[model samples]
Target: QKEVEQDPGPLSVPEGAIVSLNCTYSNSAFQYFMWYRQYSRKGPELLMYTYSSGNKEDGRFTAQVDKSSKYISLFIRDSQPSDSATYLCAMSEASWGKLQFGAGTQVVVTP
Candidate 1:
């Protein structure tokens, strides 16, 4: 089984709408979950991160993890056109260099 899996969606949303993204993992050893946003032809930048199981919210972004279910999610509220980008879910098993990544989901926020 793949360690991590995410729907690579070209998810389209209107401006000011809420966007939801999710990922799942089969490995119970994963302790760190992270979400990253990348613009076309650019490097990914970290958006949110959670340690183990819990929910974290920052501004319009919320990151949630369910260790028992091996699932994670990211929610963006009041999304803007500038938020259009590729979102990637990644996890690590207590090793910084050994992160498992999912296929990035592309988001387009239309004005």
Candidate 2:
């Protein structure tokens, strides 16, 4: 099985909708959980990052990690058309650098 699994969703929603994206992992050694947003033709940018298990929120983005369940989630509140992009979930055993990423969920927010 893949170390990390995420629904490669071409998830579509209207503007102002709350979107939820998730990922599950098989590795218990992972210590860092991250969510990255990538626009077309651009590199992924870090949206959220957490160590071990906890919740982190910034603006309309929230990230949660459950080490015991080996799951992680990202929630976007009031999603906008500008938010349309591919969301990637990542995890790593180290502090930084290398990380295993999910297949990525494509989200399109329409007006």
User: Which segments of candidate 1 are over 4 A away from where they belong?
Assistant: 95-97
**Model 2, total clashes:** 0
Task: Give all candidates' CA lDDT scores.
Answer: 0.94, 0.95
* Residue 40 displacement (Å), model 1: 0.4
* Candidate 1 lowest-lDDT run of ten: 91-100
TM-score attained by model 2: 0.96
Q: Which 10-residue span in candidate 2 carries the lowest summed lDDT?
A: 90-99
Q: Please provide, for model 2 over 10-68, each residue's C-alpha lDDT reduced to its tens digit, 9 standing for 90 to 100.
A: 99999999999999999899998889999999999999989989899999999999899
Global CA lDDT of candidate 2, please? 0.95
Question: Global lDDT for candidate 1?
Answer: 0.94
**Can you write out model 1's per-residue Cα lDDT over 1-111, one digit (the tens) per residue?**
678899898999999999999999998999999999999999999999889999999999999999999999999999999999999999999857588999989999999
Q: In model 1, what lDDT does residue 70 have?
A: 90
